[model samples]
Target: MSSEKQMKVEAVTAPVDLGEGPHWSVKEEALYYVDIFNQNVHRYHPISGNHSRMHIEGGPVTLVVPHAKVSKTFIVTVGRDLAVVTWPDPSKDCVITSYKVLSSVDAQCPDNRFNDGKCDRKGRLWAGTMGATDVPDNPNPHLGSLFIMHNDAKVTKVVDKVSISNGLAWNVKNDTFYFVDTCEYKVESFDCEFLRGVLSNRKTVYDYKTSGLHPSFPDGMTVDTNGDLWVACFGEGKVHCIEPSSGKVKKDVDLPTNSITSVCWGGPQLDHLYVTTTKKGLSKEQLLAQPLAGAVFRVTGTGSRGYPATECNVSLPK
Candidate 1:
């Protein structure tokens, strides 16, 4: 068993429908997340009491992170398309690059879209995918994939046949890359070789048990300064701190909303932990009880900045 971690909730809120990806914008000293159904970008601050939202004309902007160096600019995905939006510029308008969409080949149904995503240590963008709707008739089971978009306008299908491709992370030592099979309720680790864009020796790193405690399927995940994985339990209103090497849950933080979706570490000193939740599949009682459903929340005592996504690096001829 790994050393135990303490967990607590500093704030309770909700977002739109699916709050999957959580990223830290260092320059803004705040966290950015998406409401997949609402097609909006949310910003939250833990220290200065600033929170707001901007509507983007897209179906689901899953992940929004710095598009380049700290210039208040970010790159995001609107359904099957990618676009660039500058921050501090806070304008609803965005600039999208003309990059080819991920192939809509066999096994990849059309209704599906991008899910949990992050940039690697080398400034490459990585994100997972899943069927657009998770119902009985989707027929797209295991149709999702893991993808990497090189700065050179090339994208690689790292892994296919994923059901819910959520929660992507890499250890601080830069040796192992972590992935979450959200629907499978498992987290796996692969050898870290960003330059070569390779994965090997895939092993189960974490699993959410549903017996003793009703931990929802783990979704978007990030690693903290101490190398612990902070996982957002989708069905359960909670986040987990676990040791990846041993697959042991060290601590659990309960969220006010029952369906907490994702988490991240942000702030000037990297001590604030931000979380996002959903209000999509809820009953009247559940919605009323968790009125802040689909809102974003923050908490202290979680300590350490998890990691920031890298922008797809574009190199110009020298």
Candidate 2:
């Protein structure tokens, strides 16, 4: 559709338990995503309509960032460890059989697990950890933390006292960074050092308020070429495109499912908008009403464009 308000949403994949982390791979011309609870990594070829999946055994792969230099290699955040996932012979078989742990998160905080993450412009992997679900009734808001994995595989703790770290993106100018801690119900900004993977001067730029959309907790986020943020509202089934300066809504894309998890721009020209959803906490009736809850959806011909996704420039050690 030509109108932004009346954009068409199409289902790209079947259902997943908790679908998150939608990343576009320019090299493969495909969309890469994960089902966190299902512990599966999926790749979809837009042209052939071929969808392939591989399940990780021990833990869930929270996010996948394509390596900037190495083909078929990704800087992955697996469970609570910073790891590298690579397809040694993808031309022969598509299954993922190798993943190496670059560094282990501190064992003192057993409740922490890696969640949503991405890389900065300079190729450093920036992933955040969240409290484990075993203690949902007593979620330690301060236990979660954000970290940076350098090119040499050194990990650094950058932000502390975080809970449910979700969306992360830099402005179009690459001078400012925006991050979301879902428990806070707000999007915060900081001065960014693209080369060093450093952040400072935390300030709230866009805060969420429940309107007709209850529990509009900010989840996954992405930046268009315009520097505006398209943030998925977890319980609202809506994605808000907000301006960074005044924190005002530019446009909203509504979907049929309530638990909208993440969004990214893909396709050849990076003009298509891809979204991920979840069915984790739905009741029986809710599931019945929204049968396509856990599927990945996309909005095509939106008249908007996205920046070329930054690849994970940091390479894992051999």
Candidate 3:
């Protein structure tokens, strides 16, 4: 574990309204993420310090995953719809050349929208939705559900009655699935069956309420090569590395601002940790005090490495 003094944390992009998902694409040798409120997808190349964004004009773009078999195409969740997007050039800011909606969920709840998501090693996408957060920092509870998008483009509901479906990760062995429902304030694990795309043996791995880390919400997360979980603490402004087996906090990496949204591993060796944050809901005083609230940050010298992000293998509609 790298101490706060030894860890290197640097802002990598200009502040956005809300920065959420941070994914490192090994193939492109770049980092990809989304600005939900701004309705855009951004790509940042660490080597050249070049950053570009594509305006997603449908709705709030929650997450973006590269397609396993298609180049320049991706699987993204725009509002309640699971969609496909094509980005012809990533070196410059541009509009998506093509867009297609595969399916939409929460038809009965007009305010429900997709939140956090990621692909399994098998290239299956697992994403969840959250009820409207009309009230600042308070999302409607129990209206969300988790779903899996298979390779055939089939969508199936896996878990129901969720509140603020947030961070998600799968273990190195691909047999355990870890998740977070922000409202619950706990990290839960599930026994995974990749072939059938099902989860069982649900158990709480870490409880924030009891861990003395209150007033903070567990948001985005990722697993390191050692199978430990790195969870972003939204209000706490830190990332806690937890050992899944013992559910113990192995280490903590503090950020300069609150409202930390997500984290991912980048760099050629997958040893750099990339973090995202949001400026939404901040007051004039809070904004003044936290100028870097919405900027993307990169932390290195954590003494750990992460696995390459798995691309979505879902076949697009012909």
Candidate 4:
């Protein structure tokens, strides 16, 4: 297998138990990510080289997006509920009381919990779900699903029977939406009607399982300005830039750890690729080999750029 190599990558911080869900704050000039197993939300300032985390008491925070209207507020998926939370001040201890629950998921699938999510250009929160870890051995992965939380406080089920819903991205034109169900080992695309937040014409854009080029599955993803999709390869320690139309791998950037989980583009010009990895399931020997397993990394000089993240404007009932 051939790989396109041009970007330079490096670790920027120490590792977290499960460093996932990376989000770039253009306004704050900071990067935010979550430590899923630790139930913590972290903030990192690249220039200052400072890092801090706030504890989420009851359940883990799967993903977080900036509020569309409020500068210091955010919309996040906490456990099986949707919430509006304030960005914690790094100078003070993060208080759990700052979060307000806006919506709770279906009680029918109590084993299900929210996983990866972000706001569409229309400011709607599109998030996916997965089975809770507490379930019995090898729980029903098919129980997972994807959902849309609208700006008007309405919730709709978009896709069902999904297992381990992970990465989500949209083309620069906003006409196509890409999704990843990690267990399926493929990145799927759908025709997206942005105004109404409707998706149709589902098709596979790329299949890692069939490609046999890598030993990992696709996790988190982001789209570039040139319309290529950059996806993190869990257990493979690399991120790939793929051409969506042809479903071909155009480029790949290797990392120091094997469990890379997610990626986002930030920096003033949106040229920096920030990545997150995990240290969750490594054996003693494996951990020793990848001491930076759960740390966050950044890749620069990639000759590509990404679109800005749309803020979450969905209104939550007080």
Candidate 5:
């Protein structure tokens, strides 16, 4: 395990209220993340050191993933709707020319909103929704579900009765799918049928409560070339690298704040780990104590590289 002093952690973007769902765009050579509460989508280019954000009206924007075939077009989760958005300019904060709502989820539960999401190697978008967290860490339980958005605009619910549906990753071979439901305090794995978009044989890979990592809610996650899981521990302020096969912690990278929200692999070589955090639930005293609570951090020198994030393959209607 590496200590905080041994890791190179630096802030890459200005603070955001509730930062989550980070995606590295290999085509653009930049990083895109969302500010959930503020309803904003942000972009940062590490090469030119340019930072910009576009306000997304209608509802809270939880994620932004690039389209596999379209330039400047992305699939975003706005409130409960899966919308296709287009940003013509990358250098400036410009209005989105196209915001097409494809389909919505949990229409019965208006309080439930989209959380973390990512595309599989097959380019299918897998996202989840959670009940409102009006009281901070204590979210309304069992009002969430995980869904897979097909290329044909079909949304299928894969898992239900979830609380705070978050972090997702697939194995190197694409046969195993990893998921996190924060209230469950465990990391789960399933046999994945990528072609059919089916998941079965669910098993627990890591249990935070049993491991004694109390208060460390598992949030966004990513996988490296070595097939290890890097999980952001929201309350613990650390990212724990776990060997899924054995469910053991291989390394730990601590952050400066407790509200660590999500993480991704970026940089030209994909060797850098990009992390997002939040300041939504902190008190004034706690905020003062942790000054970098809501900043996006870059951690390098981990000796691991991640595969490029898969883009959503669905074609937008003309």
Candidate 6:
């Protein structure tokens, strides 16, 4: 099957330092995402050009989604724990959850917050980890693993040895899951059983190129209406649209900044593509030059919206 030829970008916010997870709230018609170093999650409206921020009383926030424990609830991943926030109103009345750490291994270091995550069809939270040290000299994927949390708050290590867990997307119809071992610059797919929360038969669905106009590493991603995988390149300055089955580059949307972190499909028809980026880890000289590097941007062309993330089941022992 042949796809489109061009990609476009619309600027939303400036200097999105490590813009990671982008999720579309259809009912609210708002786009939600986090700027990792900024310690904030931003809500943006495309047509009205209005946006708002929720400044957490903690370190950087990496990902946001409809809350796992409650309906109409939202999950905000603070550094070490997942907080539940109630967005009863778009403009006001938000209560943040003081949740317990659901991961089996506790986070004991500073700066090591949850990186990227998504809820599977059965509403199970699948989150990835990064190192706690924020220093540049210590660039290692320390203790990073992919985890699954059930409704009871029981956490299981689905996979380990991940450098940076940045991307999670699945094809429900095919029972196929696409997971990203981000620091390695590739996307791998596995067969999944929703009821059992198990994965098997893994293979490389899409491997990003190191030498090209394509982005540096795939950060956050979502599947399209046509099963196309849309990935945000953390240092590459663009989103790589790929055919997951064939591992072919269909198109790449260029952005003004170099750190494109997360992406989602939105718009009244779910055709609008929203991207979050970062300015984190850049040298002082680089920051001055790319002052607005860590901002958010939008793009539209495929006329596809993202699927809503289901409520994750955290199976806790009573």
Candidate lDDT values, in order: 0.70, 0.81, 0.89, 0.83, 0.90, 0.70
User: Lowest lDDT 10-mer window, candidate 3?
Assistant: 132-141
Please give the lDDT score for candidate 5. 0.90
> How does residue 244 of candidate 1 score in lDDT?
76
Candidate 4 per-residue lDDT over residues 269-292, each given as its tens digit? 999999999988799999999999
Better of 2 and 4 by lDDT: 4
Residue pairs clashing in model 2 are none
The TM-score values for the models, in the order shown, are: 0.85, 0.93, 0.96, 0.94, 0.96, 0.84
Write candidate 6's Cα lDDT for 1-318 as tens digits.
234455466677655556768888776777877767667777776667677776666666777877545555567677767656556554442434344444534455454557789777767778877786533223766567777776656677777776677788888484888887765667888898767778888888776664453446777888887888888866767677888877887777777777767788777877788887767778898788877777777787765666764655554323
| Runs off by more than 4 Å, candidate 5 | 1-6, 96-98, 134-139
Q: lDDT tens digits, residues 1-318, model 3?
A: 444567788898999999998889999899999999788999999888899998888789999999989898888999999999888888888876447998899998889999999998889889999998822246468888999998888999999988788899988777889999888888999998878988899999999989887768789999999999999988889998999999998888989998899999989999999999999999999999999999999999899889999999998888
**Candidate 4, which segments miss by more than 4 Å at Cα?**
1-6, 88-92, 133-139
Q: For residues 155-270, what per-residue lDDT tens digits would candidate 5 score against the true structure?
A: 99999988888889999888999999888888899999889989999999999999998767799999999999999998889999999988999998988999998999999999
Q: lDDT rank, highest first?
A: 5, 3, 4, 2, 6, 1
Error of 2 at 177 (Å): 0.4
- Worst 10-residue lDDT window, candidate 2: 88-97
In candidate 1 the C-alpha lDDT for residue 156 amounts to: 78
User: Candidate 4's error at 145, in angstroms?
Assistant: 1.3
Q: Candidate 1 lDDT (Cα, whole model)?
A: 0.70
Model 1 misplaced stretches (Cα beyond 4 Å)? 1-8, 12-14, 46-48, 70-72, 86-88, 91-108, 135-139, 209-215, 303-318
Candidate 1 lDDT over 48-97, as tens digits, reads 66666766664677888666654655667777555566555543333333
